[model samples]
Target: MTENQILQVLDKYAKDYNFPVLDNYNFDLAQCRLSVFRDDNEWIIVFEIVGVNPSLYISNDIYAYGNSVESQGLIIGLDDIVSLPNEEDLFDDEGNFLITPFHLDLIINSEPLIIKPTEGEYLELGIQTELFNPTKLIRYLSSKYKEKFWLEPLDLLNEINMSEDFKLFYQTDEWEHTDEEKPSENKFFQSLAKAIVLNDKNLIQFKKANTHWSNWTWSDFEKQEED
Candidate 1:
């Protein structure tokens, strides 16, 4: 059918449905192309609009001509669309139907954080050795330190630049606080204490002390006391 012929068909439907034709275009999907007829296509067409703040409405269908049969289908408003028709035949479809546009009323806005387990392991050890409680460490660093430094897990790993020895310390329990070992003498324990007292979020400098150590030096103990 010609473009003019298609437009005539769409006009008839628009009048019957009391819908005004806004615009039309051709859509392509996969390897196929089809014509899209629209009546307010400029308006955002949201298919699921129940929970949406401002609902959207779509008023067109996609149509493609085949050798034996002409196929027509509604364009669903979602991420999974594969093809759209060309600009010409959009109004050539035989019928006019009103379809609810997909509505994604994304109300909550939040940034996503990607955490790696390997990086998390190192970070957990670094914080623990510094004498901060694990839970408190994650919370404080995530809120305070991370906010200021904008340090993500990968950023933390890159900053530390630990050697194989430090990596091994993280692998082993050299920094973990045990019942038998008091928090005062242990370097890891003291670091945790200092981190807690001073509220330090500098994971880069903190990971510098990743080593197999039985105790902290007098200076380290003094730092915690002053903090």
Candidate 2:
């Protein structure tokens, strides 16, 4: 949508629902806000959206973000969250929790609205061997983000242009990512694709018997002796 149009939607939502937003917004103030009401859905995921150019990956055809999050973005008072996470468990402590700011995104086009973390999101928070507070927090948000999208009957696509001018706060091309293609290449996708064609149908396979060390267990003389 045009910047103006996107702002209008965010403006509408800011009025329609109350989602947790950053108190530490470091960039120029958000051009606008996007929101989702507390719901029982488990879909507000955390993952990187931007990366080095071209190697860049995205879920929707596009995404929208603001300035660099290192100097920016993040958190809730926590106790006020409307969904399922217990308030007592969210208390901030000096240890066992890394209460840092967050970077976020608004997924337009696909679902009615999805507020995902572009940075500082730890998806494995609840499942890790150590139960991190970030995990609990993310899980809580994800669950709350689970409302079905408002795409079809709403015909949101025609109404929104997503704008050509928005910029990413950041993408972890230098960091990690979730499960998908290029197992080894998932982190820095370009590194692997540059080294070898990942999606190539003629991908080469290696067999130990074809290497010079393949003869380490025996020699011609040993074969002759066997004969």
Candidate 3:
């Protein structure tokens, strides 16, 4: 149907659904579909709208949009989406990357640094590592690994221009204050960075110590591990 026709149908449901709109005549739709069905032998018209948010009534729209909609079938699939080559500079004239580094954080939280009691080491600043502190989480997660750094993990954080917060997690047993062999500083950051950027992991691909692939997430070794 034409955009006007679809707009009319959404308008018809507008009052009943109270979809977030600037006015009575307007609604946002990036994409939409109209479905017709027989329910209890009566025809029902369904409007599926992929709405874009450009307003303050987002919370109302989020739950309200789906409230009046019902399902016939649901399908979700994933495929590699090809990104077109762009000659556009990724950085500004100031030499800073145009893209921003997004940090994932949560409400203040802490998790214990798993240490063997035999070592008798403790932090006076609370025995548990602050999981919310990126550096401590990095170190704590690193302590769980047994691999040695192929690329000095601490150095990797600096070389890649990671923030100062990440620079403190040393990839060594001494940092952990335990005799147990240190986990790979290299793999620890690699794994952590990989996890942090799982959606855009390729955005900062680096050839680290143990891995040969630049993608890091998928390789013969990684695939084998997953299998």
Return the top candidate by lDDT: 3
Structure candidate 3, residue pairs in collision = 145-183, 147-184
lDDT for model 3, on a 0 to 1 scale? 0.25
**lDDT tens digits by residue: candidate 3, 71-182:** 2112111111111124333335675433221221211112222223211221521223322222222222223331221223333223333332432211221111101212
Error of 1 at 76 (Å): 2.1
| Runs off by more than 4 Å, candidate 2 | 1-79, 82-89, 92-129, 140-145, 148-227
Q: Please, what is the TM-score per model?
A: 0.16, 0.18, 0.18
> Clash pairs of candidate 2?
1-161, 1-162, 1-163, 41-146, 50-171, 74-102, 112-150, 125-135
Candidate 1 residues 1-227, lDDT tens each? 32233333333334443221111112111111111112211101011100000111111122211111122122222321111222122112553222111211111112323332333553544433233321222232333222321222232222233111211111111223222333243444344333323334232123343222213222222233477
Q: Which is superior by lDDT, 1 or 3?
A: 3
Candidate 2's C-alpha lDDT? 0.24
